[model samples]
Target: MMTFYNKQTTEQKEFYENLLSSLASLSKLFSSSDTPYLHYRAHEILFCYAFGANNISRGDVSFDATKDGVGIGLKTFLHGNGNTFQKIAEFNSVSDEIRELGSNHNDIAHFIADKRNERLTDTLSITSTKEMLYHVITRNNQSLNIAECRMSFVEKARIKKVTLKKNNIYFKDSLHEYNFSLAKNTLYKKFDISENILHSIDVNIMGNPFQLLENLSVFDTKESTKTMEIILPLYSTSTGDVGRSSGLNQWNASGRERHQDEVYIPIPSWIHNQFPDFFNYKGKTTPSFMVKLPNTDLVPFKVCQSGGKALMSNPNRLLGHWLLRDVLKLQAGQLATRQLLRQKDIDSVLVTKVEGKEYDYELDFLKYGSYEKFEESHKE
Candidate 1:
């Protein structure tokens, strides 16, 4: 029942309208048409700004933003007859399994529904959000429409009918309609705009929007800032598996009987060579620094062990407790395996240096194969 549209104040609505108008004014830059187009990232950021919410799009979770314990998935698309099917999920990694299910519509529906539910459950666990909903924006010739609806899990058990036509599979549950594209390996949910539209605002597209940019003097400044970040794999890259005596299973590391919380995130040597100044490490002492968790708590951390290979919480147990127990829902002695990580669709942690008066960093979850993409982007 957590609705973003119903909870917006007049001031917030005004701000949102103004933001959309400003965005619409730049439509001519992309297209000659008067119809306004809103970029998805801009929608996510501006929505968070207007509503005083935290933007979690970079986390790559099911939801893009969170407010009042509610996780919201923001969507923007062209308006069509107050009813449209927008993509909600992609299953490229599991497309083979879906194809193997063949013409068995019931089995395909169940598989897709289960995968969707798993993603939602994992997102909720990581973000600690109580509810999930979709806050959508639909663009027309001269206006933008806003709508909100519950992001419900597909009722797999109650799927009454399913149809397969060409490369698309269509199904209906008690709550909603769904479509799976075999060619694209994607899932889309139908949104009824007429029933859900809470607000509509007219966008007056400026004829000479370039003049507005020309008048701005701030663009002349040369100073720029970029976030320093890196992604570390959860499993050992050399062995291609979660080592029984290392990584998340560090408690099983030989030599000394370990506490249940004895675990550390492995930092590759290349990171130390490339960004030597990123971590404050000198000689033998482990220099402690603060790390902001996704839940907004600042916890002490340090680079320890020979060659600064391990990044761990101050007591070495705090990070493990959160990553292994809380997020992954693993028991005290449960071994964290690479298969388990892949099953959850997360295999790495994104560490971003927090720019402030104090030396600190922030951590977020990244889906599997993200580290390779990050590496490719940084390749010299």
Candidate 2:
């Protein structure tokens, strides 16, 4: 087993130990029994805080936090002898496809394996993380165990056998065992504790957490403000796919032969109609602003084309190079199809308005149906 403490300083180890104990003690307020439970979200936040990592949980990608170019997927579950199968992915959106495959174990196994691999690829591309690992926290009533293992893609070629029982399908690659549930449309992977455990911590549950809270005289109740954001779909809404002659395939748009990197994000007319003041523009002049990319580089952006229907980076190719070449890994002159977007589990980019600026925004990728969810949340 790897020693996580060996890589940490004495001070860091002390802080981590204290943090876990405090969390355990505080968890008593919500539990009916004396046993303290660590919530998964709390584990993610505190893990990042203790390790000086950037919390990327909001992105809803495979990983929850990143540090030193490593993307970490945080998992916390009840520890039962340090070995258990925990959920790793969900395919509820494609549940119909899995159901249609029925009892074809090989086909179902291959299909889900491909989907899992696609998400891993998408996570790495979007986060620009050099490596990925699962940082799991397994907890019993009195203690928590930390384990680390490589976050691997399901080896499609190495899928040796697939078995089906009831609504669950089981399969294994050379490195890991996987289970897929048709009932829940979720994927689970076996985490072998004996092979990966790095640290073990004992937490003391407070007998009376209510008394501790009652001793505090003041509490902060103010809620943090939500960022104003908009979702712009990668595919054209009119066609439900990348337009052959426009959108991401704009290189094929007629006139003169265009550069392969001449793509632009399409902005629907309804977006401007609903949020008229979102983009800055005068009567005749085009609107120009700055967009901060995931890599922290700010590039000049402009709304162009008739009725301001396109959002393109100034010098135009910059945005395309990042979106098409870097993130999507599209080849030159290759069209960005809807299938390709779905494979990446991302169909849109969320543009959040930067504070203190009317036009400047930050861009992050979003999963499919995010735009629909965003709109539903804003319904009158």
User: What lDDT does each candidate get?
Assistant: 0.83, 0.80
Model 2 global lDDT (CA atoms, 0 to 1): 0.80
Instruction: Give a tens-digit lDDT track for model 1, residues 224-332.
Output: 3336888888888778888898889999888977889888888877777777777856645477889877665578999988888889998889888888877888998
Superposed Cα deviation of residue 313, candidate 1 (Å): 2.3
Model 1 spans with C-alpha error above 4 angstroms = 219-226, 280-286, 356-359, 376-380
Can you give the TM-score per candidate against the true fold? 0.92, 0.82
Q: Could you tell me how far off, in angstroms, the CA of residue 136 lies in candidate 1 after the best superposition?
A: 0.9
Against the true structure, what is every candidate's RMSD?
Answer: 2.4, 3.8
Q: Backbone clashes per model, in order?
A: 0, 0
Compared with the true structure, what per-residue lDDT tens digits does model 2 show for residues 1-380?
Answer: 22334566778867877897789877677886555688888887888778777666766478887766777888888778777899999887787788898789899999999989888887787677878888878877787777887689899999977998897899999999999988898999998877677778888888788898889998664643335778888889887888998888888889996788988998887787777666754334375788876644688898888888888999888988888988889999788898988767778888877665433787877877776676676534
